[model samples]
Target: MTPSDASPWNSPGTVRQLGKMLFDHNPTLKINPSVIPSIVGWGLRFLANSTYERHKANMISNIRIARLSLEALRSIRQTAHLNYDQTTRGTMRVFPRGGRMTEFVQMCREMKQWGVQFEVLDQNQILEKEPCLGAVIDRYVGAVFFPDDESGDAHKFTNEIARLATELGVQLLLNTNILKIVNGSSSRISHLSTSRGDVSADVYVLSLGSYSPILARPLGISLPIIPVKGYSVTVALNGWKGGPTRPVMDDGYHAMMVPMGDRLRMGGRAEFAGYDTRVDEEEGWRVLDDIMKILPVLRSHIDANAVLNWSGLRAMTPGGPPLVGPTSYANLLLNTGHGPLGWTMACGSAKLISDLITHRQV
Candidate 1:
C-alpha cells in the first residue's frame, strides 16, 4: 500500500495511529525509541559541566523539556528502526535510536502555528516511559532515549521521491558519478562534468549524499561536510535472547544496535576512511562489546561468528546541523551535508529546498 494509504503522516494525530500500528505490527519500525534522551543528556551535560558545575542538572532539565515535548505527542507518534545505549558511556544516560530515521520533521513555525510546542518531551524520560520497555518505579531504565519521534525507510523514501522527480521531467542518472564542475568567471557553476554526457539544467541541487564536497568546490565555496563512515551488521535473531525487544546504543563507543524486521542491525563508529565501504568485523565486534555492557545477561547469546557487515558514508558538516539553503550561485541550491540525520530530516530538508527553489520562500 502507498504511504498515504498506510498512514496520514502529514497530521500529528495520524502519526500516533501509524506509530502504534508499526510499533505493534512492524517489528522493523518498532526499535530504539530511547536514544533521544541519552544523546540529549550527554551532549548537554558536556556543555553544562564546562559552563558550570551543575551542567548535569541542566542536562536533566533539558531532557525534561524534551520529555514535555515528546509527551505532547500522542503515543506512537512515530516509530524507529534504531536505538542507542550508554552502558559504556560512563554515568551519562541520554541514548538515542536507529538511525533515528525521523519519518518527517514538522517545521517550528508550523508547530507554533498549530499550537504545538516547538520542543518535544525530555529525551531521558522517553527511555523510562517507553511502552516496549519496563523498569522499577523510581529506578531509571537504561534504555534508548529520545523525544518521541519516527523514522522511515530511507532507501525507499529516497528512491520513491527521486522517482517522482523523474516523473516531473527531471532527469536523474544513477551509477553515473559526477567528476568535476565547470564554473564561470563569476564563480558560478557553468556546467557539471560527469561520467555521462553533459547537459545543463537551469538549477542544480547538491543532494549528492556523502559526495557533497565534490560539487561545492566549483562554486568557490567550501562546505565543511566530510564523509563519516558508519558500519552496519544485519543479523537474524532467533528469539528474545538472540534478538532484542528494544533498541539499544552505546554512544561512548559510538556504536548502536537496531532491531529490524527479521534481523538485528548493529552499527556505530565514525571511521573517516575516505570513500571506503569496507566492513571490519573486528570493528563490529568492538561495537558489539558496548551492547554486551548494557545487556550483560545476553552475553551468552552473542553469536560472535554471525554478522552481515556493511558500511555507508554519512555526510557530516562541521556544524551539527545540515546545510539547506541556496549557495552563492544564482540558481544552484544545496540540500546535502546531513550526515546521520539525513534520515531524520530528509523530507523536511527536501520540502524546504523545494520551497526555496520552486516558490522562492526560504
Candidate 2:
C-alpha cells in the first residue's frame, strides 16, 4: 500500500479525531477536565492592530503552557521516545513582504513586554541562522525568531499521554464511532449515543475538533468551525547534513519544516475542501515542491520513496482563536476549533476545563 493508503492517520478526519482524543484522554484519566473554555486565539492574531496587545498576552500565556507541557513530559522517562526533546532553539518565520515586517517588529516588542524573547532578523541574519533558508532567501525579505518556541511530534506526544492515561485507569475505546449527542431536559447533555451504546456522563465536553460543529447542530448550537485541510510530508534525513536543525517557516510559500529526530516534517497550505481526505498525488508533489523552494539543497538528499505524505483537517475559525467555553447547554462544554495550534495549547486548555469542572477559579 502507498503511504496514503497504508496510514489510517493520514486522513484529515482521522488526525482531527486523534487530536481531540489526545486532549480528551490526556487530562481526563487524571480526573482533570481535558477540555476548557478559553479565549486563547487572541494571541495568534499578530497582524491585527486592534487586538495586538491582547494577542501579546495570549502569546505569553501560550508559551507558559507549552513550557508546562514540556516539564510534564520531562518528569517521565517513557516520554523520551516521544521526542518531547525540549530545546530552547528558536523558530524563524520568514515572509516575502518587507513592508509588513514593521508591524511584526512592533508585535515582537509587545511580546518582549510580556517576557517572550523575540528578535527581528533581516534577510542575511535569517540565512545566517539557518542555511537551509538560503534556497528561498531572496523570495523573503526578513524573519522573526521566537527564541523560546518549540516543536515536537504531536502524534507521538498524544500516544505517550494516552498510554499514561490508560495506565492510570482511563478506558480508551479506539475506532468507536459516535453517532449523535443527545440532550435531555433543561438544556443539559443527556448522553452520547454512540455506535456501540449510549454512554452517559455527568458533564460532557465537546472535544471533537472539526466534527464539533456537525455534532452540535442537532442541539441547536451553531459553531463557526470550518475544516481546513492541511498536507504534510515527512522526509527522512538519511545523513543529509544540510537539513535544518530547527523548525523553519517559509512565509512566502506558506510551508514549514520541523526537524524531528532523523526526519524532516514539511507541512503547509490550507485547502477548504470540506471533509474530503483524498490527497491528489500531483498536489502532494506540489507541497513537496514548495518544501524544495525553502530547502533546495536537501532536494537531492530526499528519498522520494521514503516520504510519508499526510493530510489533516484543521478546524479553522474565522479569526485564529478557538471557541472554548460553555455552550448553550449547562453541562455541555466546548473545546474545539483550535486549528494548527491545538498541540501547543492542549495542556492549557485541558487544565482550564478541569479547573472549571471542579468549580475552581479559571
Candidate 3:
C-alpha cells in the first residue's frame, strides 16, 4: 500500500510517539512502540527497493547538510575530511520506475541550484566508476553521481569531539538520565530532576533526539517530530576487490551500501514501528536480497556469514529538514528532530545551535 493508505503505525511519516513520550497525555499509550528493524540492511542499501520512496525526498535540505558538514568537520579539527580520507567520495543513486530506468533530472537541478555538484551516469559510466556494479548493471536504467558527498564513522567523530570538549573544561554528565524538568511558568528551567540527582544550569538546551517531544510537551511546548526506525548491517570487506569504492544507493532495491574504512555498511528502510528496536530476521533477509540484486559481485567478494546488525530511531520531521532553534522558554533551547539526516547534518546543526545560543548570527 502507498503511504496514504497505510495506518499510522505503518506509515513512515505519522507522529504516534507523543502519546508514549508524555506520560500524562495518555497512560494507555497504544502506539506499542516496538522498533524491530530488518536483520541485515547494509544501510541505505535498500533506497531502490523501499516502497516508501518519494520523488521529492527533500533534496534542498540535503544540500544544506552536505555543505555544513564540511565546515563543521573542519572546525572540530577532524583529519578525516582534511586528509581527503572520506571513504566514499560520493554516492551513486540508481533506480527504475514503471519498467523503465529512471533518471534524477529534477534532483540534479535542485542540487545544482544549491551548489551541490552531481553527474548523471549511464550503465557504462557506472560500471567504470564502480567495477563491482558490473554484475547488476543491467538491472537498473541509470544512476546519479553526487561527487561531493562522503561517508565516515560518526561514532569515532563523536568520541573525538567528546574528548576535545572534556579537555576544554566542558563538563559531561555520563550515565545520567533526566526524570523530569522543573520549570515555572516563566521561560527558564530552574533545574532538572534526574536519576543521578538534581543538576542546575543557567541555560538548558535539550538534544534528547526522539525523546525531546515527550520532555517538552509537559511544559506546554509542541514539537513536530516522529521517531523513524532505520536499520544497518556491517560486513567485513577484508580486502575484497569487488567491494564498493564509494557509497551506492540502489534506489531500485531500496537500499544503500557505504564503504566505511575496511568495512562495508549497507542499510536502508524506514519503519514506523514506534519505539521498538528489535531486529526482524525475515525482513532483514529481504533487505539483504535487495542488496545482492544491486551488486551481485559482492557475493563472491565478501563473506556474508559474518554480518553485524544495528537499529536506531531517527527523530524525523515531516517533509524533511530539522527543527533547530529556541522554544517559547527563553532559557530552554531546542536542538532535536533531526531524523535520518542526523549524521549528515550533525556538525552543521551543532554549529547553528551553538551560534544561536551565543547570540551570534549564522
Compare the candidates by TM-score and give the number of the best one. Answer: 3
Per-residue lDDT of candidate 3, residues 1-362 (tens digit): 01110111212222333333335331212223343242123123323222234323444554565477666775556443233225646777776644223324553665576676677888899888988877667776777787767676666667767877787899999999998888865667888999999998867888898888888888988776667677788778787756778888775455788877777777766666666789865555556666778767666766767877787888865545567777777778887877766777777878877788788421
- TM-score of every candidate: 0.58, 0.76, 0.79
Candidate 3 minimal-lDDT segment of 10 residues:
1-10
Q: Rate the local accuracy (lDDT) of all candidates.
A: 0.48, 0.65, 0.65
For model 2, how does the per-residue alpha-carbon lDDT over 174-203 read when each residue is reduced to its tens digit? 887889999886578889899899899888
Arrange candidates, best TM-score first.
Answer: 3, 2, 1
Pairs with backbone N, CA or C atoms under 3 Å apart (clashes), candidate 2: 33-354, 37-324, 37-325, 41-321
lDDT for model 2, please. 0.65
Give the lowest summed-lDDT range of ten residues in model 2. Answer: 1-10
C-alpha RMSD of candidate 3: 9.1
Q: Which stretches of candidate 3 lie over 4 Å from their true place?
A: 1-62, 78-85, 97-103, 360-362
Residue runs of model 2 more than 4 Å from their true location after superposition: 1-88, 96-99, 122-128, 134-141, 360-362
